[model samples]
Target chain A: MLSIRNLKVTVAGKQVLNGLNLDVKAGEVHAIMGPNGSGKSTLAQVLAGRDGYEVTAGTVTYQDRDLLALAPEERAREGVFLAFQYPVEIPGVNNVYLLKAGLNAIRKHRGEAEVDAFEFLTLVREKMQLMQMNESFLNRAVNEGFSGGEKKRNEILQMAILEPTLALLDETDSGLDIDALRVVSNGVNSLRRADRAIVMVTHYQRLLDYIQPDHVHVLTGGRIVMSGDKSLALELEKRGYDWVKEDSAAA
Target chain B: MSLSAINQPAAALDHYRALFASRNVPDDALGKLRRASLERFLAGGFPTQRDEAWKYTSLRRVESRRFAPADAMPIGADESQWIADAGHRLVLVNGRYMPTLSTPAPQPPGVTILTLAQWASHSPTQVADFLARHDHAAPHATPPTANGAFEHLNGAFSDDGVVIDIAPNVQFEQPIYLVHQWCMPASARSAGSHMANPRIIVRAGAHSECSIITHWVGDETAESLTNAWLTFDLGVGARVSHLNLQEEPSRSFHIETTRLQLATNAHFGKHDFALGSALGRSGTLVTLGGPGANVSLNGLFAPTGTQHLDTYVHIDHAAAHTTSQQDFRGIAAGRGRGIFNGKVVVQPGAQKIDARQSNRNLLLSNTAEIDSRPELEIYAHDVKCSHGATTGQLDPVSLFYLRSRGLGESEARALLIRAFAQSMLSTVQVGAVREWLEARVQRRFDLSAGEHS
Candidate 1:
């Protein structure tokens, strides 16, 4: 479903991602494990088409289309979603209002009818229940005055609502507690299907215990150094990343 | 001073002098007020930016035009049908009361509604007493001395207006709507632009409660000027809500000054909306005279396409336990300039006074400008007072958040602007008026797509 070949990226005159390559097929879940400052978030941001990131040399193809050429909103309309590490607090903008606009935009792009307010509210309420959020969450400002766990849950709720083709979960499990982690993992697992893909970027192996990935890749110094099954996550958690770094250096 | 600044509007003064002479009733009390007012206006002339209160607003548009007091022009009933829902409409065309155009409710025994001329003829002593108490104590009454220029001008040239009096303990459920319409004269050069100066006096006796909605509109094609002055007095334990809407033509000018006096436990709330006019200014001065009195001054202005709007507010906490709040917002686009100056004063011995002032502005274009200043003066100890002013573009993070949610850039911008406007507009207690103002705001932004709910 997505391909990245030799992705080289720079931000503010500093190189962040250097010659990183990854590929994922349809319905596959890939977990990119990396240490701090390894450009994991940068890869997620680049895929979602955020500004200020200069792609020095790379090619990202998604569903037979050049993804980097589209604007941020166009990429969203084309069914690309990014669950931010830190969700932005936008005061005065209603949560359900935004979800409706997003859903209608994607539906319009696919030549479908727009969802009316009543129907949209019904759809959002169901997702809200799945995310374990209260009804008042729909009326409050988007993420304003929300706690860390609440923000993470809001990101997952948005992902569930948009139903994107390729979902990039950037550190989604960093600040969540055990209960919130269960809820968010349940929400993501419910979205898994044959035609959809999810890429989870994390620093710890706790989230994999809930939502296991098909393939596990350890990212060190902006490049994928090792690939293994889910047991590698447990191995990294038990032994740490220094072994992989030393092994890659020796290779 | 510069030559242009020193050059007074001679034609305007001449026009006022002629009108005063034509209507001067010798040895009458109203004439006495007019004569003294004319002399005061002559002394001050037209205020320039040199005046500290009017530093950001200029009256060049008002001084350049030669305007005569508007005559009673023929207006068809269809012209005012849109304002039909307004209860007890008192229509004034060209500063002249049109009995045929007005629809007043049946007055109770203690409630009195009549034109200023009729009041002078019927109850001259009472009229003299009211005008005397306001005009003599005016300089020290509400705004001190800085805001007396326009009040003096309106007093000098006000030919006709409405007087509403509510007796003790009277509760008026329906609002009294005053519609001041200025139709263009046939000849702009010969007859000059219309200058409609209407005076409104609202007095609520002890324990009385009421609401008033004042609308100012002018011809869209003609050059006109509206210099209005309103005085409100709330007796002990009275409550009053006043909404002032200025919707003049884009090529015209509108300036208004409102003076308020709140007695012990009196509640005075005002909503000043300046949404139109080529050059518009609305100034409000509220005085909390007795202990436990409270006031709220909330206003908003949106100007685009070379329009200039200014809102000035001053609140005085003169007694202990009094509270005052001021919330003003401005939106400028396409070279539009908006100015907001708000000041709060907590006098000596006024303990436990609570005062808050907030002014937020949005500049939609690079050429648009906003000048906002919020000031506080506290001579009393043990008081709580705070003020804030912010002028900037929309938040980039918020914009990106909305755009990433599949809203187009313009749609996202409109949503944020609407939310900003709603903050001030939602304060209007009247549902119908709030809805009408919301529609007007939507039209002002040309936003046709988004749901306003």
Candidate 2:
């Protein structure tokens, strides 16, 4: 479902991702783990088509199409979603309005009719229950004055609503507490299907206990130095990332 | 820049003199007062950039045109733009009261509504006395420069407007909707240009409460000038809410001056929406006179194309325990230019005064410009006063966040702009007025976003 080859990316004249490669098939989850400034978030942002990230070399293909050629909205309409590490606090845009507009836009792009208002509301309410978000959040401004846990849950709620083909979760567990992490994990786990793929980037191996991944990769010096099964995540969490750097250097 | 430019002021003065002579006004006290005001206007002439208050705006376009007095010519006008179901409608065409168009609903007891023309005709001396009493500049306040010039001009040519009086302890349930519409005369093209000076006076007696919605609209093809003045005198513990919507044509010019005086424990709130005109200026001066007075001023100004809009707000806390808040937003697109100059003063010995002023601006195009200045002159030691001003374009992060949610680039931009404007729109308590403003603002920004993309 997704492929990246020699993806060298630079931001503000400094290289962040150099010679990175990854591949994933449908119905699978991948966990990318790294230390601070190891280009984990950079990879997620670059895949989301954010500005200021220049692709100096290589290609990214999604669903057999060159995804790097599409604009951010185009990428989103083509079933690509990025749950931002820091959900922006938009003070005047209502939370539910954003959800409806986004869902309708993607629907329109897919040549489908707009969602019915009553049906949309029912779907949102059911999803909101799963995420444990208050009903007042629907009318309030998007993430404005929201707590750290609420913001993360809100992002997961959006993911559940949009139901993208490929979901990128960047540091989604960074600021969440134990309860919120459980809720977010439950929301993510419920959406796992045979035709969907999710790539989660995190530093800790704690989230792996809730939503286990099929594969784990250690990113160091802007390259995927090691790849293995879920056991590698526990080993890295116990030992640290320096050993992987040394191992890759010796290789 | 040219020889004729130097003589422009003199020529403007001569034109006004000719106009004053052509009117053949009676030699009564009111006429004398008008003559004096005209003299004052001629002495001051048109304020230039040299004046501190007029630094960001220029009146050169207004000075270049020789405008004739507007005539009350009845023509077929489109009333579709007027707010429907608005209570007790009073329509004024070309600054003259149109009784035929106004609602004939009998006013409740203790509430009086009449036109300035009708009141003057019934008791000219009494009307002249009322103007004489309230027209003077407040003591210890900074004398108006450009605003003074326009006020004097309105005084000289003031013909008709609405006069509302609420007796003490009276609660006027329905709002008073005042509509100012313009229709071009058949001879307007041959007559060069026409101008209107309409005056609105409202006196809310002690313990009374009322809301007034004033709308200024005109024909899209009319190239007329509207110079209007509004005054509010709130008695002790009275509460008043004033909403002014300016929606003149792109080819017209509009200048409005509003003065508000609040007494002991009185509350005054004003919402100003400036969304039209080629060159428009709104000057508001609010004075908190007695103890425990409170005032809030909220405004939004959006200028597109080559339009220019300027807002000047001056607030004075003259008594103890008085509070004031001013929030203004400006959006400039295309080659438009906007200015916001707000000043707050805490008078000496006015202890326990609280005042805050905020002005934020947005520029959508490379050529668009916005100048925001928030000034505070605090004299009392036991006062909390603060002011802030910011001018910038839309936030790129917010833009990306919206677009990443599958919204188009233009759609994202328009949504963010509307969000920025929502803060000001939410302050309108009236449902109909708020909805109307929301629709207008959304349509405007949506079109601009389409044009830019």
Highest-DockQ candidate = 2
DockQ of each: 0.65, 0.87
Could you give candidate 2's per-residue lDDT for residues A1-251 as a string of tens digits?
A: 89999999999999999999999999999999999999999999889889999999999999999999998999899999999999999989999999999999999999999999999999999999999998999999999999999999999999999999999999999988999999999999999999999999999999999999999999988999999999999999888998898889999
When candidate 1 is compared with the true two-chain complex, its DockQ is 0.65
Per-residue lDDT over A37-89 for candidate 1, one digit per residue giving the tens place of the 0 to 100 score? 98899999898887789999989998888988987788889888989898988
TM-score, per-candidate, Cα-based: 0.93, 0.98
TM-score of chain B of 2: 0.97
What DockQ class does candidate 1 belong to? medium
Error of 1 at A127 (Å): 1.7
Q: Write the per-residue lDDT of candidate 2 for residues B300-392, one digit (tens) a residue.
A: 999999999999988888899999999999999999999999988888999999999899998888889999988888888999988888998
Query: What fraction of the native interface does candidate 1 get right in terms of contacts?
Result: 0.64
Worst 10 residues of 1 chain A by lDDT: A90-99
For candidate 1, give the lDDT of residue B408: 75
TM-score of 2: 0.98
Tens digit per residue, CA lDDT, model 1, B20-41: 7787557577778878888888
